[model samples]
Target: MSVHDLWDGLPKAEIARRRQKNAVRWQRRWRGPDINPTTGRLAQHKQSYSDNQKPQALLDEAAQIQSPHQQGTRSSSVTVGTLLDRHLAAKADRAPKTIEADEYHASVVRDTFGDRVLSTIDATEIEIWSQRAEPAASSRKKQLELLRAAIKRGVRDNLVGVDVTEGLVVSLRHTERPYWSSQELRAVVDAASSDFDATMFRVLGFLGLRENEMRTLRVGDLVGNQLTVRDSKTRAGIRTLPVPASVLPSLVELAGSRPKADWLFVSPRRPGNAVSKGYANAALTRAVGGANAIRIDPIRRLSAHGLRHTFAAIALSEAGGNLLSVSRALGHARPSITLDRYGHLAPAGLEPLMALVDAFAVPKAA
Candidate 1:
């Protein structure tokens, strides 16, 4: 019998109502056909769980009881598909965007190893699968990460004996972000024809805000010498940054008695709207072209993001190789991310550690 058979041909609304009502009740009861097909009689099936069991877990258990075949018998062994279901169930309360991303990642995993037993997956097989799975490194890495998470859930539930991915390592093979030097940035700023272009470039180079974040800035976001990011793509992206003294006048002038809720950078095409990405890009393109015309060393063509990178590169040098300051400024969720991207720019030498070792040594002669 299928799980829907327990509903006894009830309409969708009634089934939903009963499911909602049964969600809180301790004993889950459902009616289905008798074990023998020839009996032609209805049999009631009931199951109970402890109060400590979560509602979702209880629902999954009820599903197993109603239709073992449909739910895939858990009595034998756990499969990758089962672990994925558990993983997704645990994240039901997350944001919709996050859930969507998880679903996409799960689909990528299911296509390759959904039916495989969790216990049988080992590091060697995982490594081989990763190599042949997907050609795109980033997508391949995300798929492996999702599979690893599912295996972790299986291990936690005691369905799997050991974690095979514990010792596995995968490299992302990232490329360095493009950025401009101080002179190139100065040239671009000098070449800007209007105050609007100059201020936009200053914000990108000096403050290191993302294009979206900068465009969405409001008059109220700037208070005194600090700016608060109210809207961002990630939680870490919402933060307050100290505006540079050099750019304060231009920023204040740009804001210029506008209402608190008004977009800091108004769109010319669409009234009462924030600056669009195309407009921002076109502005940067004009500045780069003008800078190239005047300078002996032509500035490389790069996106607005390169200006943010320029800020990080310069700030790291100015802050005495402090990754935390630069990471926080860049709105990175973790300092390790900043170190991973810009650690090569830090001064490399073991002289201080060597001096410490010498200090700990005993007298050479007595």
Candidate 2:
């Protein structure tokens, strides 16, 4: 019969009692035949242990009798470095950019715990290491999470018994990126030193494309009113976006006379290559801070990503807070992700809902 069949119709208390009795019996059997080697007589096993000895202590004593190798191979075969290497190797199919970040995080893990055996590292050691690492809250969290994942792989591979990074918490300091108003975006674009720089800033603010996505655009990607993003960070990012009417003229002017295979934005130094992300960012900073344009304060200096936030803010406002429309336009993987990041920028219509709740209230007996 199956184990479930054996338990059928038995009272829970009775089942528990029988289970404990069987466990004790099995423990005795596992301890081996009790006949004394000298007398060939059954010895009193219970009487041999002091009353103060705990059940776990007795189990530990039993474990000590077994060969260490038979108990576990984790200590002998698995080091922190070994588990990290295996984990990284298993992620060979991940994107090169993703793998590069993983390698950097793996290097941090190796520097902290490389020589230690997997079995010897525990939660306390992990917590202590995190405290000493002194990385930013987010970076610390990622490193610990990566270590936890590697150790979990070790557990699945039977190289380790427990995950050491479990239950460790890292508190992050919350900071929001500064977004731009419509006037601020216009001011920055107007300040651009060249037509190319102005068009690039307008594309970022209008289309909400990532820096890398903008750089990889080819002349063929732009049709009449639509711009196709062929390469992106996620599959959801590959999408066709409608070109904003305001930026359409500039985009058309920029693409004029170029072959379909030519890059939409080529570097001034290199005829065929796109502008480097670093140079684009530096140019943007200089343009925004230029004396002739609206002077951007040091605190509100726009980064390339800040322009994307500016797009989200303007799009949500113009769409009357339609999250899905804004999310789709921005090529976010999910509407929920868009909400989490940019919810504050959306219009708050909660006052009407609150009024409805107030109407249902009954008067108190005064």
Candidate 3:
């Protein structure tokens, strides 16, 4: 007898076991409204996802799967968009900045894999996702991170059989590091038509202050030709960065208002509110050409933080890679962050310090 007949003859408990197996193995099929199979007319399916989903999209995915001619097994899937939505839901409890980053990553994933399904995705898909857009290395990294995070969620949900993203990493072959040339810095400073922006650019480019530190600098903190900045990223960012006499004049202008303990970068929107990073950036662009205002290494463009990188590079390269000292000046929580980032600036590190002994050893010929 056929299995259907045999099942009919089975005991109640056995029948329950068979039904349970079927449900567990059930793969939904998508059959859109019938058309003249000959006419090829397209039809729309109904909406889906309790609040942020669509059933028609899910149903349409089911339509593409075909059972093996000689077997009953089938492949299943969940959509990229669906997975992204779940990630978005996860951000509800995360920090504001973290939520922002996750959203941006989700935006990239949706743009790249809007129609791809989770079951069909693989390392190849991730590789393409990283390169197909061919933007910046940092952007690609964010996209890859988002995909990996979603795949991790899949593993947690039992939606996919394996963590296909196990060893995947964003390609760093063309990753551009951010640094600014002295001439470019001058060009932006000279180009500054607005007092506020010109002053901001000089502070960032010369002093190497981040958006937060730039916004926080004050008149009282300026003493003995050094500016003390309080770091908010960690308690350790509190630091003193001595200024080149050239940067002093601009610091004077920024602190002229003698604004309260309030942020120097404070937004005009509210007298006391922190100045918007966007406004400072926009002003910078206005003062300098868009390209000049943004930092770019030899080949790529970088944002405000690039100015910070440029400063670090200049300091380390000039000082022969004094990281312990640079970390203190840059207000980093730990010296390790400095080493990881600018260790290469210390090309001298490649040659063992013991190599220095060769120079010091009595110059026998002299």
Candidate 4:
């Protein structure tokens, strides 16, 4: 029989059984809500190479946190927009920039989930959205913070009975990267294309400056030998980062021709302004492609923030994980952020690594 007749040879019962199995297979693979094709805005996690195929019959259930145990059925009264508007009004007392960021999220949330009842969002959607963009660990972390904030507000306002993000994993534990050995630094910094960009990298990689701190670094910020960061991301972000002794000679060389507000690394297009960190990051990614010029830990991918992370890691490894010194270097509000991100910099050797099994298995040495 031809292909058409061969398909018809399957009995009606067999075809139904095959269709049912296919539906289950596809449904199991869906990671999130179906996305809108026109917007490229994801309502769900789509497979990377979807062929416009969907199993229409079996849309797996919406994710939910609480297994309803006679607690009231989901009250579908509140739209996602309603919750967001309420959040804006309640956050009126926060910092303007913070309020502005929330407002931006509010706009996107409204467009994305505006019509859906607050009840419809569940645990699975939460997981997929946070990690969807394959955002940098830092971005994933902040997005989770935002999600937790919104959910907490929802619970506070009686929109939900529980914060569903309690089980969320915001960032995976990552290995601490070794600071560049002198040889590696020379390979990258002294290479033909990297001379100037290397200067910018040192300010961040050595000094633990935030992206903005580096972008806004001014001719006036450098005095004699140190880069004074009096105002950084927070009130605590204000602290001077010592210039590496190795780099002072070059910085002094570059100092001869400069303007008062001229950024240390000027944006190519904007001329007088600082290089946008995002743009700088992209350019550097392209520049470093397969170029083994810098030797980071093989497992640790290098990025602009990796520079800051490496600085803290080096400080801790060189100084026995001194939280106090690293905190001051990073201008963190508390030593905790410093310790959490880079404390593992100095391998606690094998003691802590083996503690998991040792704790449970070690009988008293009677």
Assess every candidate by TM-score: 0.72, 0.56, 0.45, 0.46
For model 4, the stretches where C-alpha displacement exceeds 4 angstroms are 1-183, 192-194, 286-301, 319-321, 347-366
Off by over 4 Å in 3: 1-175, 257-262, 266-272, 290-301, 318-321, 349-366
| Structure candidate 4, residue pairs in collision | 33-44
Per lDDT, the best of the predicted structures is: 1
True lDDT of residue 296, candidate 4: 61
Across residues 1-366, which tens digit of lDDT does each residue of candidate 1 receive? 112234557798987897877643344455574563566667778654323233334465456646747444453466677777777767666656667877897887877777787666668888887777456766676677777887787667655666777766556666788888777887888888788889999998988998888899999989999989766655677799999898899999989898999999888778899989877678889989998887787888878888888888878755454778788888886676677678766655788558879987958776
Q: Please, what are the lDDT tens digits per residue for candidate 3 over residues 1-366?
A: 001133536688887887776533222233346664665774433322222243343333233333334122212456677666655665566556656777787877888676787667777767766776467776787677777777677567655556666787665543346786666666666776666677777677777778778776655787667778875565557677788888777767667767446465556677777667677666655655644545464223447777777777777775464788877767776686677577677557536566777678767785
Q: What are the Cα lDDT values of the candidates? A: 0.75, 0.74, 0.64, 0.60
- Candidate 1, residue 338: the lDDT equals 79
Lowest summed lDDT across 10 adjacent residues in model 2 is found at 47-56
Ten-residue stretch with the least lDDT total in model 4 = 49-58
Q: lDDT by residue for model 4 over 80-163, one digit each (tens)?
A: 555555455556666566667766655655555666776778877878876766656665666566556666777774556677
Give the clash count for model 4. Answer: 1
- RMSD in angstroms, all models? 9.8, 18.9, 16.8, 18.1
Q: Which candidate model has the greater TM-score, 3 or 4?
A: 4
